[model samples]
Structures are given as C-alpha cells and as structure tokens.
Target: MFRPLAVVLLLVSTEPAAAAGLDAASINDAAPPSVKLPGPHQVNASVARLEIMLDRAHFSPGEIDGKLGENARKAMIAFAGANGLSFDKAVTADLWSKLAASSDGAAIVNYTIAEADVKGPFLEKLPPKMESMKDLPALGYRSPREALAEKFHMSEELLQALNPGQKFDKAGDTIAVANVLDAGNPAPVARVEVDKTRQTLSTFDAAGKLVAFYPATVGSAEKPTPSGTLKVTAINKNPTYRYNPDYKFKGVKSKRPFTIKPGPNNPVGSMWINLSAEGYGIHGTPDPAKVSKAESHGCVRLTNWDAGRVAAGLAKGTPVTFVESAR
Candidate 1:
C-alpha cells in the first residue's frame, strides 16, 4: 500500500489560544497504536493525517484516531468512487499525491483549552428515554468536557486520555489534539448515498466528486429504512421533537405524546434533515460512537457535527439513496 509523507520529527508545539503554554511532556506523550495489534486499523500518522484532511473536505472518518480503520477505508472508497478511481484500489501513489497536495501535513497538534470551553449552564445529565427527556427545559451537554469534545469533533475519552492530571475546567491548559482541518464545509452537496451494510454515508458534489463521508446508523430489522432514493424536504436546526405514541417507537413506551425542546441532546440531535419519506431523514444522534453500532428506527443517524455539515449544504430536492453496500 502507498503511504503519504510522514513527519521526520515527532514535532511538539505549544498552542495557546488565550492562555498559558502547554507541557512539552504532554505533547510528546501522543503515541501510536501498540505494534501488537492486528487487522487493517493499525495506527499510522499518515492515515491520521488523511482522516484530518478528509474531515476538512467534509468527509468525517468518525473519531480522528491515527488508524486506517473502517471509517478511514470507507472514506477512501467514497473518494475513489467520486473521483473515478478503481472501486477496489488500495492506497495508491495517485491517492497519496492528491491527498498530500490538499492536506496539511501533521495529524496531531497542540491546542489550549479556552475559557469559553469551560463555561456553561450545562445539564447535569440527560435521561436516556425520550419520555423522560421531554420534561427537561432543554437537552444539552452534561459537562464542559463533553461540550468541548463535540466542538473539536473528538471523543471525550480521547480528550481525557490526552490531558491526564489537569482538570479541564481552567483555560490555557494546552493539550495534544487531532489537527482537524480548519476549512469551511464543502460546497453545496448534490446527492447523498447511504450504505446500509457498512453503515456509512457519502455526500457528493454536483460534478459527482466526494465532498464528505460519515458513519451512520440507518434503519433496523424491525423497522427497516426505506431502500429506495428519498428526497430531502426540510432542514430544521435546533428542532423540537414531537414524540407521538401512535408510531410505537421502541424504548419510547410513553402512552401520552410529548414535545422535547431543542438542544444538542435532543432525540434528533442538533439538526433534522427531514426527507420526503414522511417519517425518515438523516439526523444527528445523542450517542455518536453508537452511530454504526446501534440501529435507528428508520431514519439515518449521524454524529451531530457530521449531520450538521450534511444539512448545511443540502436542500429540498437533493436525492438520498440507501444501498446494501458500495458498488
């Protein structure tokens, strides 16, 4: 397999936004995956950089861990398909060449925790059931760390593992974080394809180039998602969720219907890209890690950040097709 250029030096830089410098030891502590691992997800700085680049281009590879795992492979395949590369092509010199030109070199960088990051009227915790959630004023992050993690498109576990001893409450605490690309969302999306088997979604441009990809939780066995192409009919930001008992949604066993106010923790998450299918569309989730692990009732579910990016460039006539796998 071809590889992108790797950093000659294990570079460390103190990145403070409005605070003190970072600990050099903490930056150096960013390590690769243990060599004892097996399978395709081996930790590679080059792959991590690719993940960052893909994210900048709007195709998120889930968590930006430096490994060519499932999300990385899916993103590559989508890129290949969009660019007219061979469907089964492994990482080729051509791919690396293109990626290097478009991608910033490093996969990891130092970032300081901001004062605003720790400030909040945060929720103590959100109830798991939608019925219980309906009683809350608004569904939001349980902690400042959770809010910061989502902001950086990172997992809270990854953030905690990086910082070690310091409480994340203070600003100016510099930490090693995945260097996600800082570009704006991709140009308007033309269509979106959902792969049910891989549990992924790839957004394409009008010219059919890959704009972005995201891991998704499509429909379930009990209430399978519509397989045919669906048309996007609406985009609702910070949407209020109406829980109607007539639908008999699983885990939501409320006889009386309720309305859940808008927030990040809303059942449909930060945004709702409703489809013409009446009951189904691509939306955000309360749990991003479970996007592919768990099943949705019928709607396609993505992480809030990923879903918002998709929604930002989509509109009422854009096509969304559900397929078993990539062709």
Candidate 2:
C-alpha cells in the first residue's frame, strides 16, 4: 500500500517544463487513501506526474488526467517492456526511486526500436520469447504480450490468441495491437448506456449506432444514477478534480475532502465531456476493463482513448440521451 514519492507540486509551476529538479514536498503532499476513501482507482497528483513522465517518454497515457486509466497503466507497462521494468499498474519502489532521482525522465517515443536505435547493455537485456500463447511463461508472457498490451493500452486477454508467451521486452516481434476501430468501418464515437442492474456501459455512436459495449460501475443501487436525457455541456481537457466532502455515500461519508489537480492520477482522465444530466457525463478512465464493472459516483466511465474520441468528436450541446435499461 506504499505510494510513490509525490512530485506533483511541480505541476503548479508555470514553467514545469523549464524546471530541472524534483521536489520532495510534492511527493509528500499526496493524501493517504484511508483518510479520503480513495476510489477503487488511485487518482492523485503523484499518479498524474507519472502520467506526464510516461507521455514525455512517448508512451502516451492518453489524456494524462492524473488518473491512471487503462491507457496510462498500459502505457506504463509498455514503457517497462521496452525499458525492462515491471508491468504492474502499481508503481514500484524502483520505478519511484528512478522517477524521484531523474530531473528530466525518458519519453515514450524515445524507446522506438530501430537498427539505428543504439543498444546498451540495459537495452540488450530482454524477456524471453514464447512459441505460442500456450507457451507463455509464469509471468504470463515470454515476450512483450503484456508490454504491447500496455503500449496500446489494452487488456492482455484480448491479445492472447495472437502472440503467446512473449516477454514484454522482447524485440523484433509482431505484437498484436488493439483493434481500436472495428473491421470494415470504424465508428467516430462510442455512446455508453448505463444499466443499473447489470452496471454496464453500452457504447454507441451518433447515428444511434451500436459500436462497442462493456459493463460499467454506476452510482450505487441506493444512490441510483439520475435518469434523464441530456446534452454535452462542456468539455474540459486535462481537468483537475475537486473532491467534495459534502457528497454522501451509501456506507461512508466525508466531512472534509481534498481537491486534486488533473493528471494521470485524477479520477477523471485527460478529457471530461460534461452532460446535461447535471453532474453526470461521460469521461476517460485509468482502467479500461474496469470501466463498466466498477462504480462511479454516477458518471459514465470510459477508457481515456474512448472518452477522448467521444469528447473530441462531439461539441457542447451535443444531444446525449440517457434511458433506464433492463436491470
């Protein structure tokens, strides 16, 4: 349960890009989860900083909302795969120590494998390769299956049939990337319909089209998501989150809550498309698979990629219809 050293105050400086040193106060400023009832996901300043670092490395965490959505986690793993770091979403001490030590960390695009790309001893070392999916090792991959999963920010299970037993760091192999768009025609946007009983979000498009679908975490059965047809209110890019203490929960309540700035760690990822349904809207997340399965205070949850597409495509006042689906 140990968190990384926070260096997010650096986020405030108008010249974050120009500053060259890491600050300790930023690391210590992250509020403990136990005190604030941290959401199922870790959205805070420190995680946001990590997202920025990953993006700088050319491993995009997709919107860098301080909330580690599936893209951020996967990007981190991809970076790890390329650089030989562990792929777990939880930041390790080694990763933290490195992040803390480095003034200007590596960017994601910096690790592209080219014959021209120089190879050092650190770069030469890599994970083993697997002959097939069944050949995957204990770490679940002999090659970069998991690594590639993080690269495109997708679930490893989705790529199982393609490359099995690949080490995350293995070079010169074709790893399956996520099918971002469907075969034939790709949809411009995805619409999420919240099902109270199933607690899932069904993705659709502007033409009343059904594109993709998944389960969703909704407002608790008790809180119950407010039902209504709404429109896109506003789109906030890389928004900072303001945690409200007055908000009530089914089991717990907070007297004083803290507001966190936007980054990969914020509960809301890089983009937030507010809906006409008062506080409810569709937004990006750190975890992709967890989208429909987990609980949101009430808002619709989507992967940063999915959300960004939706947010970017639609304008404020875009009609967003919400209907109660079968439980």
Best by TM-score, which number? 1
In the order shown, the candidates' Cα RMSDs to the true structure are 6.2, 21.0
| TM-score: model 1 vs. ground truth | 0.80
lDDT of 2 by residue, 1-327 (tens): 011222211223222211222122332343211122223243344554565455434344544334435445545444554445553434566665554343253211113332321221221122221111112122211224433444444455433322345344544544433322222222444344555554444445777654433334566554457775667778997766555545564433445554445533246756688877656667766555666556777777766655665565566666655565442
lDDT of 1 by residue, 115-217 (tens): 7878776788788778888888888888877877787776675555555665677788887666653767778989988888778887888998667778888
**Model 1 residue-pair collision total:** 3
Clashing pairs in 1: 58-212, 59-212, 59-213
Q: Deviation in angstroms for 215 in model 1? A: 1.6
lDDT score at residue 129, model 2, on the 0-100 scale? 16
lDDT score, candidate 2: 0.46
For model 2, the run of ten residues with the poorest summed lDDT: 129-138
Q: State the TM-score for model 2.
A: 0.45
